[model samples]
Target chain A: MKLFFGEIYDDHAILNEEESHHFAKVLRGQEGDVVHVTDGKGKLAKVEINSISKKVVEGSIIELKTDFEKKNYYLHVAIAPTKTMERLEFFLEKATEIGIDEITFLQTFHSERKNIKIERIEKIIQAATKQSLKAYLPKVNDLTKFNDFIKQDFENFTKCIAHCEDDIVKTPLKSILENEPNKILILIGPEGDFSRDEILNAEKENYKGISLGQQRFRTETAALQAVFAIDWELKS
Target chain B: MKLFFGEIYDDHAILNEEESHHFAKVLRGQEGDVVHVTDGKGKLAKVEINSISKKVVEGSIIELKTDFEKKNYYLHVAIAPTKTMERLEFFLEKATEIGIDEITFLQTFHSERKNIKIERIEKIIQAATKQSLKAYLPKVNDLTKFNDFIKQDFENFTKCIAHCEDDIVKTPLKSILENEPNKILILIGPEGDFSRDEILNAEKENYKGISLGQQRFRTETAALQAVFAIDWELKS
Candidate 1:
């Protein structure tokens, strides 16, 4: 069965431009053809095409299922963009496949790329989600100043910052994630790493120091590795 | 100090083209400058430059320390390349950063990519090897037909294949890697995955069936995740 993503519960569904083209031209679905739809918010709907036009594809919902609940934990990763945009995009695609709930791009003192195109990243995330048969799309936040970004508060969360500096309280991400708290966030720095002041500020804000591993991983690699480790610990 | 890669036994050292250009032109290093060099076989050399030219930078090895040895375990990941060359390159970069002994690109039954630019992939491996300050380069093999690729024999090796299928034995990679075997190999299929017949053939070949996790992952993501997971199990 072919799967499509669109709005659900509104009686009529309108496919986005990309999705419209894919369904109409790529898959050549016609009126009355059955298709699966996801709202990208954990709602999966079975729909039959009511009309197929170049600009829009309208469908009628035949069946619906809500998948709002996942296995109990949430994962959030904030990291600097790599100097190369491709690497950052790779991180987004893999992180989504591995089930990260939220991703924030930070502009740290040593950050090489200060800006990112969120639209391009969103397309990648959507494609990855669809490919992985996931109903929920991971949220992508715009780039923010490091200090300002670190100020956001969380509820019942174990926050951690993965840094390279010695003398910081450090443990493997797996060890810290053993208990598998309901919500967790981890910070990964750039190639040059977070500045001393940035680290100090994050520490003051209650971000515990954590290490991904002994190897010095690139910004994006470290973020994905942390995601993998977190999932591994929780599942094991 | 600037670093260069050399051979452990090479008393006479002429820096490679990339390194010589980087040190002499990029960094403006002059004669009498002390620099660090690694044979990339596990020997570190403290050298003083005696000559500098456009083609070669010759340095006198003032002191050398041989510290390179094989890791207690080996990680070899054989994966089918994505249609996009960039994705395979990204996997190579991350795998090198995290450390791997060998990488083989296979042509699976569903593989869209039939050929890979071996030179280009090797360049990425070398760049990553230097960036991560590693003493060994991961051996990269050319694209091989899946059937022929699986025919190779191994001794004292634990072999496994990662595929998305309902009937796969699906043991966790962690459990498969728990004994810390000296040699390990994991195979990851391309996008669209291996056909049912391919998985059965591997089962006949004495390969273990393993699952990375519950969430679906891309070809490259699965490859690197296996690399990280196996290393974590071995090193932990």
Candidate 2:
């Protein structure tokens, strides 16, 4: 099913500008034609086009569904951006395809890349979401400082930090979610890994230190590995 | 520890041309400098630099180790190449980081890509191996016809195929490997997926049909999913 990103309202929906152009100009869509639309917020609809233009495709919602293909669990992956933006972007695209609820770029002690182009990241996520035919879009937040991020409240979430410190005995992520908690938050470290203080601070906040197996992975690879692991845990 | 890709011998080792340039010119190595080298065939060594040049870095193996950090299981993922080359390259890099033994490209009935640049792919695998400090590199084979690929001898391997056909009651990949089969070969379909006739042919060959999950993934994503699943199975 080809899903176009757009906004869904009570009785009608509007395709986003880029999607509108594709529907109107690329696909040569016409009035009265039915198309599948998703608002990337668990809302999907089959709309009949009432008007079509290059940058505006207005349609009346012939059928609307709320909580469309809802996810049973929520996964939030907070990762430190890689030294190279391409790797992080690739991770975002694949994670979206694999299924992610939310993402955050953590500015850690050893994070090399400080600033990221959120607009570009968003476009990549949207493309992957449409390509994978997933209705819900993964939410992305601004880069948050590690200290500030840990200060936030995560009362009900199963918070886990994936670190490579050899001194601590870490449990595998797969084993931690045996009972299948609905809300999961995973923290992935940077290339040099989180500082000793960062790990201790997280532990002080009651964050469980988890492991992503023995072999070491790059910053982006670790994040995606965690994301894929969560999906495997929930799906299986 | 930073790992460099090279060929290890009984008493000495030689870095590949690209790696030699990196070590001699980029890193400015001198005589007596010790470095770690992996032959990508389960051989690793600590070498003391005896000679250094732009394209030739020869060293004496001070400490050689075979089967260094060896994996417990062997995973072979055969997937159809994606239409876009970038997607396939990204998958190769990530799969190497996640740990894979071998890979093959299948020219299926609906294959979008018929040929690939092996030199480029080899370079990617080498870089990922070095970056991940892996002693063994994932062997990549040339594109082969689907029928020819399925006809190959896979007697000792637990062979499985992943497909999205609704009619087939597919077993989850995780479930099939519960017994911890050491050698595993998984087949992933193209963007258009495997043709019905192709699926039937594989089934006739005693290939167990498998599913990655309910969600649909692109050609490259599906292949990486299978790779990750195998790694997860072995490491956990």
Candidate 3:
């Protein structure tokens, strides 16, 4: 069954513009057709299409399913965006498919790209979620300054920073994930990597230095590896 | 220090056309310059540029270092080529970066692509190997049929196949990697997945069914995940 995204209002659900186009034009969905829809908030509903339009598609809920897939842990990865948007988009798509809770673009001292279009990233996230048949939609937060992000209190979250600085004896991410903390916050730097002061500041803020692997990975690859490592550790 | 690929012949080394172009034109390497060269066969040498040309560059070995990173275990992933070449190229590049010993393109029942250009893929592997500064260059074999591949004798090797068959209760890859076999061979099916008979035939041939993760991953994603999983298991 193909999955669509929409919002549930009362007994009806309305798909947005893109979803509407996909349903009405691409899929050739007609009135009275049955479709599966998700609200991106862990709600899945079987609905009968009542109206099909270019802008919006309305449907009446036939059955509602609240028991969608739920993640066992919370994974928040804050990464410095790559110079090219494709790499970051690829990371976002793969991370969504592999199960990530949240993603934040960080503006660090060595970051090449400081600004990111959240709207574009959100679209990729939604598409990946639907493609993977996932109920929970991961949030894409706007770009935040590294200093400001570190200042925010994570409280009980297990914080770690991924850098390539040789001066610091970084713990392997696999070892860190061995403990399997319920909430994980990992910071991945850009191509140039985080500066010494940035690493020190993060360490001061309780972010432990962690290394992804022996080979130096690109920004996007490191981010994806972090997500995969976390997910692997949690499940295993 | 910049890294170049060349064959150390006696007391001298010769760079290939692509490497020569990169050395002479891209980097503007001049004579009498010192550069790090790798033979891609677990050998790294410090060489002095004796001659520079667009077609081929010659260097004399000044010092030799053989202490290259070696994997304790062997990983050979045989996967069906994706419909698009880019995804397969991406997988090759990433697998090289993440440390893979061998890659084979398989022609399965549901495989969208049957033929792959070995030369193009080889270039990607060499570039990724240089980018990661690794001494080991992975081997890319020509495309082979799934049936033929399964029939081959993988003596003393832990052979596994990744298929999305509904009837079979696939073992998680993590569990299979727990034993830490010295040699591993994993086969990843294409987009439409392997035919039921293919899975059964493999099972009959001692190929264990392994699941990468819970989510449905694309061909390239599954390949990369398998490589990453194997590397992680061996390293940890």
How many clashes (backbone N, Cα, C below 3 Å) per candidate?
2, 0, 0
Clash count, predicted structure 2: 0
**Considering only the true interface residues, what is the Cα RMSD of candidate 2 after superposition?**
1.0
- Model 2, residue A25: displacement in angstroms? 4.1
Winner by TM-score: 3
Ten-residue region with minimum lDDT total, candidate 2 chain B: B227-236
Predicted candidate 3 versus true structure: per-residue lDDT over B82-191, tens digit per residue: 99898788788888888899888899999878788999899899888988888889988899999999999989899999988878979999889889898999999999
- The Cα RMSD in angstroms, rounded to one decimal, for candidate 1 relative to the true structure is 2.6
lDDT of 1 by residue, B112-131 (tens): 88888899999889888777
For model 2, residues B164-228, the per-residue Cα lDDT tens digits are 88897688887887889899888989888999888889988888899988777888888888888
Say which prediction, candidate 1 or candidate 3, comes out ahead on TM-score.
3
Candidate 2 C-alpha lDDT tens digits along A24-46: 88888889888889999988899
What TM-score number comes out for model 1? 0.91
Provide the lDDT at A120 for model 3: 87
**Tens digits of per-residue lDDT for model 3 on A72-92?**
888999999999898788888
The DockQ ranking, best first, is 2, 3, 1
Reference-based lDDT, each prediction: 0.82, 0.87, 0.88
Q: Give interface RMSD, per candidate.
A: 1.2, 1.0, 1.1
Per-residue lDDT of A21 in model 2: 92
Model 3 alpha-carbon drift over 4 Å, by segment:
none
